[model samples]
Target: MVKEVQKRKINKEEEIHISSSDSSSGDEKELMLKNPLKWWSLQGKRNPTETKRITLPSTIKLIYVTLAFVPRLALYGLVFALGQCCRAVAKLFCSSVGAPHLANKRILYISDYMPPQVHGIALRVSQYTKYLRSNGHEVHVYTCCVESRARTSFDHPTLPFVANPFNSGNQISYTAGIKLAWALGAESWDIVHVFYPNALGLFVLPACRWRGIASYCSHHVAMDDYANRYLQIPGSPLLQRIMFLLYNFLYDACYRWPASYWGDVNASMTQTFVKRHLPLAAKYSHVATIGSGVDTQRFQRRIPTNPDLLWLWCDSQCASEREALCKRIGAPTNAIIWLMVQRLAPEKDIHIALDALASLAQQRKKMNKELDVWLVIAGDGPAREGLEKRAEQLFTNDKNAPGRVTFLGAVPNARLPSLYRAANVFLTCSRSETFGLTVTEALACGACVALPRCPVFDELYGHVLPESWRYDADDKCGGHLALIDAAQAAASIEASAWLEANPIDASWSAAAQDLDRQYDQAVKRGKTKYTSLRSYVQKRLIHLGRASLLLVAFYFVLSYYWRNIYCAAQCRIFLPSLPKPVRALCILTFIIALEWCHC
Candidate 1:
């Protein structure tokens, strides 16, 4: 009887234990279903015996799948719908306006400078005007009167006007405003395109608006950057802020406002420039990137079998003839020539190239390798004298010998093709370049190019050129090392093969077609709806608000720091002899003078 009772108790206890275990297992299964991510993460830690296939409920599984894809599906759907809507609107607008009819335009190109300026903007204007005329468009240019010697055959029909006495540069001519306005009033123009928003553009844009003519402006240089570089202002926070305010005010008044108020489009040479420098213009006008193109057919490789024969060809007076000038200069046939074709300006960073070359020469000597390397600089500017002196100091040595570096001065455009072809490697170390025309020309001529790692260079060649061709110019040692590597690569058999494969399309015809499309778009947008008076009023208010804010900030800074500044100015090292009272009076007087000037 006792044994029977013990057996019954054990069986009951076992049943109870089993029930509790089953309940715990059910709870764990529910938890796993609720948090599959956690469950999966912890799955690897579980023993093989403990592992089991998890059978989730159909409702839960469906919910999980839906959650995973619903947001992505909705986002994709929205994008597709927006794209379709935009396409439909554009198609409808084009059809209604008969855009195809306005294919060939009567263009009036208002430029600050033209050919013979020997500047990038001038070259771009000349090329664009020439190509536009070739494409069956009647194009006329209005520019300031230049010297008879500075004029080109292409300048025919280009109306030149007298400039103001106070003009800052050869390009800027204040008096051209009146002539431009008169010309616009008399003529019928389909489109008025301003190359640079200088004094000329300010007048031309307003005249185009008054005459109800479509207009556009091309952003060539970043004025703020130029000011910062050239002004030699101390890089203090207060000074930088003040400089920024001044630059912004000038840019808005002279360029942005005029372009936005009167012009239908604002074009930039590169997409990078359009994004970085023309944000305000972009907001109000149809911003387009119509990059300057290269003459690819003319700039092809011509490796001559005989150097002397090429030299003879170079000496001939045939302007149309192509010949390798590098061969004529007695550069070694086996030497790797690194060529630079750029203005010798401070901003161009020509000194960096020289430094790299010096370093390369030293490295070659140390390695006991044949120092068959040469650097050919092919342009001139204000920095030429300094650069030449520096080059002479660095390169002209008894052991290494001279002629390692050569200055070709400013080579003509007609001869540039041959110059580019003669060099094994073309290099540019410019700190800032909107669109590197020389770099593109070099690449088109089948020369391997080595560029400093800048935004412009990256945009131009990061995808197309090999990684070995680019170097961080910001690093001194790295830049020198990169130049050495590039020279070695250029000398190798693989360089020619690489150049043949990676041909960039940089033809003027392609650029003209792009511009044509932009012109049509600009015209379409201009005709659709004129800006309302309310919009103009809003813009004026915004401009006023910005000015007021800047003024207030300036006042606050002056008021807060005037004492410190005054004390600093009156320090023993600077103005020790002056009395404190007199110094205080002087500071007060200066402040008053500033206020008077402001008024």
Candidate 2:
């Protein structure tokens, strides 16, 4: 009875053990499915009796299983644990700081062009860089030496390339990447901010990755629209198609690839641009909608000297230069000056403004009103000659058309504020503008802007600008009529009063602050990614080292058993007559086969 009771107790204990082990295994499997990284924990807590009961053919099989499975389990566990720890630390830090700390950042700016290149992007970059420097940040620029006049400039050597076929002024360079990398290595830059994804900017992206540096890129131009409209190789459709494909490929390589691979922060000037182009902004981690900033204080309203004399501010230094400009393009002094400060390019749709001027003159003449109107086009481009010829043709029939239109080739940036002050109205007919910098400047200078009703214009100034200032570009007659009405309203005291009441708040200081926030976020993200990668590598190496030790132990165990079996075989079995060296080699081969089969 006592023996039977002992047997029953033993059976009950065994049953309990099996049940506990089964439940534990089930829980582990479920956990593993949820997170494979937790699999290592199962090994240490496994039933010892279960391990003993599981018989294998050889030690080699045991070693192979350990090498293949155990290391992977440990590696996963280490990586998962590290990741969790990092996340916890990050949360704690963020809770403490309220906002990420941003101060004294070493910023590197890479661009294709900077001022004295008369474009919106160049001006925007210059303003941002200047403001960044003023705000106690170390800022450096890397760009082509093409035509820059900045005293403290670093120009990357470049190969000539025509960016826009319609305008010679759009010529840029493909910067040497190797040279740029060397330059970057020499500097201890904290952040690399690329203005536009041209060759110089694109080349530095990989280098940023190699050096473990955070990178950012700002989308400035609509490359596809520009290419489709302007990159025309006339008389060859195949060549045109090829060129189009090439340009698109270049765009993708330069812009999209760098943004994905190296960029910690990607930005666009307008919310419209961010929404449209970078729909994957959330997926990329950091994206910002920081628009261009204007020097509102510098571009303030200055009282004109004469109300009757229409002032056309173009690229002229003095009275003699202005007189020569007037003579070259027959500009009237007494008429209301309709100022156009833009590059003379087809993309600008300067002809629309010219056509509007001609129509306004005809309407005034028919109404028995004084046709005292002069159109002044400021800035120069490839289309200037053609535009001048078109202007001459429009005014030739009328005997009193000597001072109807004039071209002020190119204007100095310093003189723009005074020019804005002098003009009654500012006009633009650009179909594709990423951000209308000049328009903002004109508005800040107290001149009412007469802009066509495009998406960009509507987005920037639709709500802020008065109804009379906005015009329908699609409607030829109505658009021109709207332009005329806007011009007339600009001359009124009521329009000036409205502008004063609703002052433009697009300042460089605000934009710089927004950028500073973006930079901090980027740095935080970059540090997190770098830390995760380092932890993973270190854990993998540790796991690999543990697996190697198991293999070494298995080798020694196999050698010991083989020697014992070989001696026995040699003395009493098949290999007894064979030479010692040959017999030893045969036994070693047999052992390897057995090991392979079992594994």
Candidate 3:
């Protein structure tokens, strides 16, 4: 649902050139135009090759561009205008058209937080519910709420937000499921969609299935990939096998439906998690690729030029990578500014970034007799103060370092786009990732991303990094070394040995470029395919809604006529308990219900 909105909002104004144009900038463009020698690029150039190749769909493509692209864009504009006519009118139609399937289908969205949580999954959940409600569907989101914080801009007060377990991470929402399911039992629901297959989904999967309800599990992250480095050690193959078996048992025993795992790229650990235990892929044939939701409304490709801003890296993964980059550039400590937007947990390995920065500061003082750098840390977690003290201790030897490093805890979701825009470059150094949503947002915002070439990272960028910069951890440059240490303690050292035994094709830079080009091609192809399907879907939904209205009206009228007959037999115009005016209102309602049936 989130991805649909994103694809729909791509206006004609955003020129998507198949061939590399001279003026495009940033990583996204760089990836798209990586292969200048490709057929797409060659066709645009003045090359003399006249050899026959696949001909162009010039007439058909033009017709499609004119009929589908142009009209839909114009229609979209009209819809926007209609919305402005009145708040309710706009909300009703946009939401309705956006999610017509919701009218007949009761959707239960089990998530961690509705909104005000900056993570990708949370924002998408909020959007899905809003659109679903707009379509007149009985949409309900069940999650725990923080009492101190108010609802977010996207959150509607009337929307139900059931409170439960409170954890900084969105994955831990087990406490709310029992109550949520109990509340939902009263409603006639067609399907239950569970998010983050690891935690909340695990809890909700079985109960929904037992009732013969259509169930879906959106595997946002594979559990094996997410476990702390300690759990991945090779010596613990027995434990690893045990964990994998347990996970497989829970998923297999519970779900008869095809379980879906959607992620940016298939990480080694995630794939291994499946192959080691769930050997047969045929069991979960419903596995399809559903990319993470992109908020087209919030993030656009507008490169902000703030002269005062030296760097703007989100605190998630790039901290350590940025430190290495700073060292390679030999940047002056003060001239270099770094931002770390991450949970201040010990496992995040933020201290490595900090330690590297501090080393740079000392080197600058010894060589140039002066060094200055500002480290801005965002996000609050259990290790916040501990990280702060460590930061202070590391920089104690410096003269201007007191005010240089600042930790502005927990910036809100609304401010992130601007933060990405303000910064010159973005960095993320996490050893593992399930397609970092922030990384995509940062790239879209036009910052050069400095990221490790992990499976998820490679998948996210479509393998579009410069060859010199790409690191798959298996490369001679110790790219895969970090992962080695992470998997050292696995139940059997064989898992780690197996990982080391087979090296990945570490051609991420070219891969990223190819991925982006393919994505553009996909978007172009998908638009046409999507348009046809969308129209069909819309028709089906509208028909379903009309049919439902008819059934509801028929029920109301039949009940009314029966009541009138009963009243007449009693020798009374209406029931004695009901007032005359109330009886008349009931009659009026019956008439309206009849009208609804006809409409």
> Pairs clashing in candidate 2?
315-410, 315-411
The C-alpha stretches of model 1 lying farther than 4 A from their native spots are: 1-103, 145-170, 233-248, 302-330, 476-478, 531-599
lDDT of 2 by residue, 230-343 (tens): 655546788779867976786676567667556777777776765565566547647777656788657766333456764433333334433544444444443466788987
List, residue by residue over 1-599, the lDDT tens digit for candidate 1. 11010011123322322111555677556656787645443332222112112223322543554464345434434543454345334433333321334557878777767766676777777777778888988777777543477454434334333321112224454334333444565545677788764644555676566545678788777666555554333336676567558657866876777876676787777777777776666677777777678865576554444666772223242222222444544455656777899876666777777777788777778887645777888876556656776777786662553566777787898888777766778888875788888888887777788777877667767787788777777665646667566656654668768877666778887887788778777766665654465347645755676677679988987776577656766674445678776766666677778978999
| Per-candidate alpha-carbon RMSD to the true structure | 31.2, 29.3, 24.1
Predicted structure 1: lDDT: 0.63
Best by lDDT, which number?
2
The positional error of residue 449 in candidate 2, measured at the CA in angstroms, is 0.5
Q: Against the true structure, whose TM-score is highest?
A: 2
Root-mean-square deviation of candidate 1: 31.2
lDDT of 3: 0.45
Better of 2 and 3 by lDDT: 2
Return the clash pairs for model 1, or none.
none
For residue 70, model 2's alpha carbon misses the true position, in angstroms, by: 45
Candidate number with the higher lDDT (1 or 3): 1
Q: In what order do the candidates fall by TM-score, top score first?
A: 2, 1, 3
